[model samples]
Target: MNYKVDPGLYALGHPDADSPVFISANFKMSFDHLRTSLNDGRSGWILVLDTDGINVWCAAGKGTFGTEELAKRIESSGLAGVVKHRTVIVPQLGAPGVSAREVQKRSGFKVVYGPVRAADLPDFLDAGMKAAPGMRIKTFETGERMSLVPVEIVHAVKNLVWVLPFVILLSGFSGRGAFLSHALQFGSVSVIGLLTAIAAGCVITPMLLPWLPGRAFSLKGVWPGIVCAALFLFVRDVLWGLHPAGALETFAWVLVIPAVSAYLAMNFTGCSTFTSLSGVKKEMKWAVPAQIAAVALGAVLWVTSIFV
Candidate 1:
């Protein structure tokens, strides 16, 4: 099958009267994984609910994966006319947004809550299964932690471009050394620092999420960022030998790196099962201003070091 992970209704081979009907969110990755997991020659109907490109859980919380959307999509896809069964299996995490009673009332189709992970779908279908306690639970495993990095990197790069030129310009103003060399050096350091920051937020923090000593993602990210910055400084001093103005540059980065990384990690609240809107809002109120201050202060110090 030449299956592409599109965000719409797709029939996986020829679904028969006994074939199962699966529902998933419109997010490409989610849809793709669902289909890929079912590649063992099972025929089914995949009805993708439009969740505005968000995964099932987040979209469910936002009500994008609610009863109304499901009802509408079922009607538009002509699913009622095509399928012999009136049962649709939905991801368990989407339970918050969808009211099974309401969906049944509106569309005459009963909603069955499926396993938490897509990989369990085949077993789930074969056993004529109810959601096991394990299947109903969500866990952020190492693989899940790693997958978030690509999107975070993409977002960070866009922001980095805007900040890079200014960092380079400031490097020249910071010293009487060869301006071009200093600028280039500054750019390199800035990129390294930013990439480190992204890794701290998107990779390390999430992998160590349970072990990270904080209730907030910002705080969770800060621990790794600070550790990463300290290790970077130690290595730089030992290997490259610090320049006369290197201490100031290092100090600025220690503060700046963690702040940026923490802020970015905080954004991952949307992806997490632990975060609530009220909790995220509260964290942002404190974390955002603190990050801005740290970045501003770091910039000021770096510029001042040039004059001194």
Candidate 2:
């Protein structure tokens, strides 16, 4: 049980002749959650189709969760020999990629669409039914909304390290006191600015997705960045002791913070429920150039502030 199974066939809790067979993506998180959701109680066969570490929705979109992979995995796993039933229950989100008829033709097994979430598998099996509307529909509730933050934070940290040395170097060139003190202050401001942008793009905007007033992810991320920049400028200049330069520096940051965050957030389109490939391509056409301009402007202003 502790060993890593190949991303094909897994037997959970010793399934018998009558046990149900479930199909899921090969992504570690998907497999782990599915097994955990069973809680050592269910007797079933889990057919993990190779999705190349991608979750169901994305894999489905990219055709990794297609009929061919499903059929191949089923045949190679020798699943037909283990189970009496010729049925495999698949996640509803994967329906777009898989042709059930083709899978049945190729693999000799009928495919049944299951509930949207792995947690609902037990009840779904107990009921012995097809997916209901609620089971098929994707929902981004509070709990689901919170889970995406860690990945975003990790990516941010990795990228932040690359930019940190430059920030320190710039801060050191800014003033005459202890280099460490100035570096620390600059680092703090930069981190605050980065985290604020992340919160705006990844957390707040997504949570308020419907009300964010944008069709594209860039626009969605931009609104939050604008609000966060306003608040940040207010707190840093009005309340805190820091003094930013003229309107240029202020305007530059207002553009820069959100632009970077928006670019990062736009990358999430591949993982989101609403984003399409065509849409993301279109948004990137405009978003990428805008981001570059904003960052360049901010860098220029920051450098100018030291001299003037």
Q: What is the C-alpha RMSD of each candidate to the true structure, in Å?
A: 3.2, 3.1
lDDT by residue (29-132, candidate 2, tens digit) is 78888889888577788889888778887789899988999999989999888889899988888998999999999999999988889888777777876555
Give the per-residue lDDT digits (tens) of candidate 1, residues 194-307.
Answer: 778777877788788889998989999899999888776666555544463366777787888798879888988876766788999999999999999998898777667666
Global lDDT of each candidate: 0.81, 0.78
Question: On a 0 to 1 TM-score scale, where does candidate 2 land against the true structure?
Answer: 0.84
What TM-score, to 2 decimals, does candidate 1 have?
Answer: 0.85
lDDT of 2: 0.78
What's the distance in Å from true for residue 74, model 2?
Answer: 2.9
Clashes of each: 1, 0
- Model 1 residue 91 CA deviation in Å: 2.2
Q: Estimate each model's TM-score.
A: 0.85, 0.84
